[model samples]
Target: MSFHKYIFHYRFSGKSDKPLILFLHGFMGNIHEFDEAISLLTDEFYCLNIDLPGHGKTKILDDDCYKMPKIADALINLLNELQIERCFLIGYSMGGRLALYLTLKFPQRFHKIILESASPGLITDRERLERVKRDEQIARKLARSVEKDDFRKFLDNWYNQQIFGNIKNHPHFEQMIENRLQNNPKKLAKSLQLMGTGVQPSLWDKLKENKKPILLLVGENDSKFVEINRKMFAVNQLCKLKIIKKAAHNIHLENTFIFIENIRNFF
Candidate 1:
């Protein structure tokens, strides 16, 4: 029953009576992405930071679909291996989108959900196709000049976007992004093209319909996801939206204090 087959690595060695918290990383990221926060959270809860398929040490799934639901299936299998019935789930970016999907699809399995800059999927099919092509092109570039997967180049290209560009100026931002992007370029590229954000299902319609406690956090100026977050809060009964000042897509890294505080307040 060793989930080492599906999970790259897991972090948790403390008591079991506490609430279980599972941390999922985004595309091109792994378990180590949560090292700083996980240590702080471990005493309050048993924290499990896992590397999902196609990231970190986990082997890529054989299926070509690699969609959110399929990835969630792998996660459910991992939980089964550990005999875990339920846990609080948190996913950032790509991981966040997957978290929302899992919660909506299996509400009984999650005590609560914390989503950071994650969307269920694009609002329309056209947007999804455009995004997939754009992301796929970037992934191709990553595969070409990854430099032992140092990915400094890929990250610079990634962060150059209006929202994430200044992350380099934030004190801990560079290190956090560096650590998260240190995985193999081929894997990162494959994950992005095969199971990237565009490949996810739009959870907008489903979020309003679900009663589970869902917290959506975004940076105030992120503009892109901020609109989505606001819309959900405006119409949804069970969802809460919190925006971190002076932060963008990577609020957890840009303003860790506020990000953690909001999550603490919401949960």
Candidate 2:
């Protein structure tokens, strides 16, 4: 669907009568990010999977559309267009942060939410500024990755981060990288510049205002987000935190069964 300069590539599947689940993917992921999970959930859930701005086949006409608030509005409009009054939401990594923003901004549009490896963004200006610089550096690298090999190398290093925690060792890791290579590196740079956590608004103060139920999923191996989500759970009365065993930032890819189990049990 095209909204202004943003063209969102999405797939809506399963029975119309079933409850809907809006699945948002992490950075470098497309609408197929949760395909395996969605395949298993088809009997019980109507899934709406979208290629977030700058990823997959989704095209961003204006860079402004990549901003958190702007993208959130676009998503709400998409739901309205689909005639979905309310639905369950699941977000992973970057998408998780966006899901949280959508939940807080348009709580009535969502029933329940599951945030996997997400945060409320940086707390203070200094932290945000520092993060912005870091993201810019990474963005520059992405922009320079015009060649397929360059992009592949970048992806390799990305998963090597401690937060990703052994994801590269997975049997299908090469396939995952192949999928990521489909994205336009320059466009991804724009997304990282505008939608990165450093640039997004801090949801820390707004967390307590959420009235809907929230499930915070974090992998035990990813201690950084574990602590972040732990603090989130502490602040929000309706939020529940679950630390998945033998996984890290990309929990769904690392432990698909447990990830699906949590979704079923939570929603």
Q: How accurate locally, in lDDT, is each candidate?
A: 0.76, 0.93
Instruction: Give the best candidate by lDDT.
Output: 2
lDDT value, candidate 1, whole model: 0.76
Report the Cα lDDT for residue 162, model 2.
93
Using alpha carbons, what is the TM-score of model 2?
A: 0.98
Task: Give the C-alpha lDDT of model 2.
Answer: 0.93
What is the C-alpha lDDT profile of model 2 across 189-227, one tens digit per residue? 999999999999999999978898999999999999999
Best by TM-score: 2
